[model samples]
Target chain A: MREVFGDFNDGRSAAAHQVAVRLDTNGLNITSEGAGVLQHWPYADLRAIDPPHADAPLRLTSRANPDARLRLGDPAFVEELRRKAPHLFLRGLAQPNVRRNAGIIILTLLVLGLALWQGVPRLSAPLARLIPMQWEQEFGLAFRDRLLAGARTCQSVAGTAALSQLSERLTASLARPPPLTVVVADRATVNAFALPGGHIVILQGLLDKAQSADEVAAVLAHEIGHVRHRHPTQMAIRVAGIGLFADLLTGDGSALAELAGQVGGMLLLLSYSREMERQADAYGRDLLQKAGLSTAALARFFAHLAAEAPTAGGGKLLGYLSSHPPLEERIAVADKDEAGEPALDAAAWQALQNICD
Target chain B: MRQLRVNLTLMDDDSTPSEASAPLRLEQRGRASELLPVVLLNTLLNIVTLSIYRFWGKTKIRQYLWRQTHFMAEPLEYTGTGGELFKGFLVVFFLILLPLAIVGNVANIYLDPENPASLFFPVILYMTIGFLIGFAIYRARRYRLSRTVWRGIRGGMRGSASQYALRSLLFWVSNAITLGWTYPWMQFTLFKRLMTETTFGNRSFQFDGSLKPLYGAFAKFWFGSLFGMLAVALLIWGITFADTAVSTRPDFPFSIAQIAFLLAPLILWIGMAWYKAREINLLASGTTFEGLSFRMDATAWNLVSLIFVNGLITILTLGFGRPFAQLRVFRYVCDRLSITGEVDVAAIQQSSTAVPSMGEGLADAFDLGAV
Candidate 1:
């Protein structure tokens, strides 16, 4: 290597001494003009501290005795040394090597696009189904208990009997009915939520707003449809999988479990996706039609909620609204659905309406 | 094309004429052309690997950053590898993520369901995590320092991570109890604690200076915040009075409370800016290593303007201007700060401590550890 100006540090303190560095058959040698002899480091023991930038301070240390440090003022000296011994430096993936870097870039983009669009969705679907029913039930029940712990459950005997009768009437037409347990919670929020494994919560405010039992049954049927489709599990799996994929790619593992926990608690609270909502509504319509109940009742309830939404106050109702995005197309389909007769008689409708009285 | 210049002054030393010695100057030599290519490649790799490329990608960035920083015309070096970072993250993920997830899910199931016990239990967990974060921050810094090499000698930190963490927690607790009035003392103590333990080669750093100089700025901020809060409370009371005595209309346009609410964030932002600038300046000036001291001539107003512009750019471009903003901030800091005094480098020998296998785990968890 050509002679170049350099600095030597003993690694003891920050004091730097100027020296001349050159490479020969005997390896790199250092000499101070006035001080005479400085140091002679063998090539085998010399370790190059690669600089990230193209032109940076050339720092090298002795592998055998790291306390010996050499800093070259000339980048050319580093270039010469690198040319002579490429094996001494660790390869950086981000270093600019046009042809190879280009290939990696192209491959990376394709994988990211594919994973986002198709791969993740395809993967999560089966994974969601694979989770055992026992786990899902425990998961669902645990979440539901925490969610409704503060709310009082209406246990009026007549109201309970009326609700059970209406549920029986509505579900009797199903091909294979799920084991449904419907509860009326004593909260004034105009909302209802369905949990995995056939648990449905209907708020008192929803019943108070309904003029007839058929209207309330229509809502329950929709929730039952959600259970039948196993939408909660699918939704939960999809969200968690996507998040984990992103985290793994970024090499961020620290917050993984914490995020998963947060997502779990919030899962039931998420209003079902639009497609799921529509499917649930369709299921309700078919079940109602089989029971000779009018689908117009479901359409009427949607319209009523939409009308009251603008006047609704507080963050509680906002949660309900966000989770249950309204679809006018579904409402129109609901209105056009034809059925033979009202399944609930006047007395049963009134009793169901007073279920939370 | 730009050329690399040695910038050698060639001035001679009279005391030791036999051995020529020169003064060293630090510089930032990063170029956009070099950085952009790496960034582009990394972005693509990040996309392809579904973010797995990021661990390596970050290494490349650090490599570029460290190389760009020159001390006495010699480029500082970064020897960290992408694979090492990836492995570190995975180890933490499997070891920490799984347990945390289980605990969190269980807590969410039992404690989140409206029970008073739920609230009380989660509070304990939060406090525990908060306390652990202190230790994690210290450990992360130690890791970073150990990884940083200059003139072949790596920088390092001493003292137990646990102790530092405990000290941080104590400060945090006191800050909470004292209505945040103990902030200056807390900041000063922590700065001294971390810096004094810092080492470049075998030599340790020294932190001097008192919070007595910062009290003036802090007091101004504290009083300003209090005034802002009182104004907000008064405005709320006035709005209620207006609603009752005057016209209780369906819509009350721009009441005193609404206006105060709008201004509260701005007030808080200003206070935070002032305190942050003063803290940074104090920290820089008070720190010394190998008989060399530092000075940061950055002012609060200058910082406020920098922050305002950075935020505006970020917002206007929808985050695309982030790199440019970051570059500008780096330049600003480098320009404003200068190291003074002398260092006895020839006397200092390489430290003989084994580097930690992995660190920055907590920083990764919190998403604040990257430097």
Candidate 2:
């Protein structure tokens, strides 16, 4: 008596064996012997066997008849096989094909390449649209006008003479005048921004926060570093790529807003690569020291900003912090070396603070 | 031995035709047993190659998992090789990553076109490509493992590449159409179809309709996201209210609201921990096969509590909470889970001794017990 279980493509050879016993992994297989003799037995018959085999016995294959097989005699083997077979089968099925795996890898790389190819052009389109060389001249003129207007505003806020005197001192200090103008904005946001073609905007709020003129100078010096490095142009180009990508994908003019939003988000979240930040910090510090301003004020300003009330909308504050090193860390680095005299006298500090009011 | 004569008598003339099927079964040990050595070897390789082995290590794990479970017959066999797959993936990935890297470098150079240092763009491009390709290979291998491991038994898993691609496309389309509500259903259907189609030896595969576990996983994920959002909102609200309340008095430098704001993240962390615990417990307990039943000995709540407590401690203690988490999960599976048959953890561990420590750590973390 033999049992065969499962679907075997090759089964005919098993029938040829005399006194053949076949065991199926799941059941039994039997054939008919005519003339009042029971031939084929079903899988259910195993249940009746004394100390019944829970699983079919292992089948040993014959070389001459590829399909012909015999069951192992040990009943224990059947029990153990039944106990573990499911897991074993699962494990076998789970194994990855080397060729298929390799194929998938290659396919994925191809997809990635395709995505980049598709994505980059979309990213670059806005930059291409904006960079016609004419925009530089237009940008420079617009920047000059804004700087002049800002200077007038500063004069109105601070006494004219004080403003004039400050400007004259700044101009005299520059041996090779940079191709840019700096004017203080009346706004109370503690921000400093650089315009294309060397125009720098310093907010009154930033000036009020600086305890000393050197801190104000530190801010200006950082802007100067940006102007010198052409950081604005680089930033514009980077943003333009993002904008282009958005515009291409959406095919909507409103995507310009999305682009701006993305750029703003990026500016807040992305720190200047460590080397870039270090270079800017070094340049600003060098500028302040040469101008006879103490660099310690920069460290003081960082500490002050860090201690400020965490901004409303955690997103904004998180955004700001993401792009900059931890304030305490930056402060520590600045305080490592103390050099030069305080750039602001008591009167100058008072005047700078009062500019916003 | 006595040759016992059994009566060979035909019961009746009406004999049912035997089903022509040859179902071959092979035992599969848990992934943890196989994963440990590969992980360890890769970690060691990583040290020797300055992180290059990180990519190779990832590929190796996928390959190892695939090989461990593969069976051509009753005695399982594996046809895939990690080295070959890794190399193939790397080559293809580099071809793609290199160009994008070039673009990044070119953009960097264009920031200052006249500088001679800009010529280093090609070198930067190549290095970036190499790194991305390595990472991509790792990702690819992982995907392959997850897909192959639960293959069904009938018709040997049918679906052409185009069909798969279409299915993936429809997955996204349906998600968009149904506003993400259909995601779980889609996932279930896809998984069931994939599992049922894969055939080996003779038996076909089938997934027991166990949507309860899946629903539990989804609920945990949803709750976790909700908690995280709530924490962020609370922080914002607290900060705003404090600013308003304190703005009138310049002398009031600090406010209670500020304290509330700071503690919001802690609350969010707890929520996340809870979610993770719930999710893991549901997934571990929910999975079952046809004609086979599985039961986790540990209560779901107990597992969840263990994870939450350990995770919180880890978070507060700068990542020292991992060992406790691992121990808890191990204890739960070893002492709690039972299949109707025998399981020997010690013996399984012994067989996996060739695996490295980090590999073992990962395997332990995932709780892939030996079969």
Tell me, by TM-score, which candidate is best.
1
DockQ of each: 0.21, 0.03
Q: What is the alpha-carbon lDDT for the whole of candidate 2?
A: 0.46
Please give the C-alpha DockQ score of model 2.
0.03
Q: Give the TM-scores of the predictions, in the order they appear.
A: 0.67, 0.36
Residues A80-158 of candidate 2 have per-residue lDDT tens digits of: 4445333222222253443454355456446544543454334433443454434543565465565546443364445
Worst 10 residues of 1 chain B by lDDT: B10-19
lDDT tens readout by residue for model 1, A1-357: 467777676555444556677887756787776666567777777776654235546567777657667766566667788765554554555434434544554565577657756765566557767877766777887767778999888877788888888788888876778767788998898788788657788999898887677778788888888887777777777666555545555444323333443554355335336557877888888778777787878777767776777444324456355555454655667666764576577877677667767
- Tens-place lDDT digits, model 2, residues B1-371: 11222222222222112211212223333345434555555545443432323333444444343333322222222222344434443444344433464478446634444666566765565544444433332333233322332212112333333344345456656778875655666666655555554333233345545666656666665566667667767766765676665544768665545655666666555544554455434443444443433454444457557766766754663332233344344445545554342221111111111111111111211222221
Candidate 1 chain A: worst 10 consecutive residues by lDDT?
A252-261
Computed on alpha carbons, the lDDT of every model, listed in order, comes to 0.69, 0.46
Residues B1-371, candidate 1, lDDT per residue (tens digit)?
22233322213222222122434446776776667777667656654444555656677777777777777555566666655665667676667665676587657754545678787777777677777788778877888788887756788888788888888888888899998878888889888989998888888899997788777778888998889878877767776776564435657666565677688887888888878888889888888887688888777788889888887865664433344455557667767778877654545667888787775666666655434
Model 1 CAPRI quality: incorrect
Model 2 alpha-carbon drift over 4 Å, by segment: A1-222, A232-353, B1-23, B30-37, B44-51, B70-163, B179-371
Best by DockQ: 1
TM-score, prediction 1:
0.67
